[model samples]
Target: MRYNKLDLNLLVALDALLTECNISRAGERVHLSQPAMSNALSRLRNYFGDDLLVPVGRHMERTPRAEVLREAVRDVLVRIETSVATQPEFDSRDTDRTFKLFVSDYSMEVLIPHVLAIADAMGSRAKLHLRPQSSNPARDLERGEADLLLIPGEWCSAEHPSRVLFDDELVCVVWSGSRHAQQGISIDSYATAGHVAMQPIEINEPAFEQWIQAGVGAPRDVRAAATSFAVLPFLVVGSELIATMHARLARLVEPALPIKRMAVPFPLPPIHQAMQWHKYRNLDPGLVWLRDLMIAAAQRM
Candidate 1:
């Protein structure tokens, strides 16, 4: 369908292209072939008389015109999705909506299982696409790429609506046979012990434990770093390395692993896991339903 000689369908491709800045990836995002995406890019270039994307050092970069259109295009698509595409009333059992969520491995282990159980009991046909935490989850929510973001309260964006789902505290974990376990961990020992850290992929910022330790002028002797919090315990097993992680996650893994959880020797703040969604999608019925399910799951926890 053309409006003023512009094919409205191209806006979908344009959004993908501008967001991804790569033709093949954009095509894959929209389920279009690479050749078809190339054709769409050519047509978009012709219509706007500008190269929306250009090659730069083996990577695609958006042109100035494309940069300007990025937010505008995203906003248009979000409005259409939330306001026009959604139904007035949500019936989870009948709809085939796919809810995309950004979550950490911790949340996936502690909370997501309950959600799936509840959804299954309700006979909901909706699909869930669980994505790993991204470097810019707020941007993904703003662009309507993520239906929800489950993260610590401190990381949530103020521009969106958020609610705390559950609370967890940080605990120190050490091998059952480690010297620290036998003697009990002290502040000095915790500060000087060889530590295994969980660093978020694609994120350059310090982890929560690191930030807290920095505030107290304490430094960890990090011996190894893993991307997933679930791996921290495994890394600590049969080793002298200590790991600081969420208490809930530690409890879940402690029964099977020969690891012991100890109280943090320092006063660290509790983890308030939160759920955030786009401000404009506050009224989306399907999202509302999914959020309710998640909240219920958290309540059960």
Candidate 2:
């Protein structure tokens, strides 16, 4: 259990140190006393003949050599943890890992409640962290910073493997007593009516509707724009303004607001919510279980 006359135990300490970059934090992670962790670091430095961690203004930063070894060390530890340290079957109730997901607020509302409730009921110590999605989801997945991306079909890329979670259509919502509701929407009426819309989100391409409309110049009028779908209900309630959004999200907030969901006056393409993950983690058992659980949650919804 030795490498280059260095004890194998040093690798565990090294992994923790490289991951955390702080002696105290690394010690806490691996259950070592601070002094013991320091000794482990000294031994590693002696073996590698380099300062693996350099002190920097009350913080520790990994040296270039340590940075070079970080992924290899972490991967080795993960392999051992996955193949040897734990039971053959992933014991969700006993796992203490955290999963990072890239998702927007609407997807979070739909998935987290169902998924976490099930995990909590099973006595799981695992935690799910959602990062508000940005335009660079594909890159985030490739870099392993995100475990999964829950995104609309238009924004998703086929560069990564994906599973369709659910399909949804856009619906125009108006206040229950609005003119659009009472008089019914015609093409001309729909074109002239004041509308609230979600601002464009795509970075590389135009939104689905934008692409479809091409040169039509966006229907007739946009009275207001909101950054998130969650604001649609509040923005439309008791107002004559109409807002178009995903039907499922419209349903989620419909009961809370005096609003009615009606088909969009024009035929629009359907959008799907899908789960996408890195090719590197596609077969990871814990992630596979999580993906399956998410699919199940979507089905139930």
lDDT of each: 0.90, 0.78
Model 2: lDDT to the true structure: 0.78
TM-score of each: 0.91, 0.69
Off by over 4 Å in 1: 1-7, 24-43, 57-59
Output the number of the TM-score-best candidate: 1
134-217, model 1: which lDDT tens digit per residue? 888899999988999998888899899999999998998999999988999887777778999888778754457666577447
lDDT of 2 by residue, 106-222 (tens): 787766788777777778787788888877888666545688889877667777788888887878899998988888876667766788876736643325557334423465477
Give candidate 2 misplaced runs (Cα > 4 Å): 1-89, 200-206, 211-220
RMSD of each: 2.3, 5.5
lDDT of 2 at 239: 78
Least accurate 10 contiguous residues by lDDT in model 1: 203-212
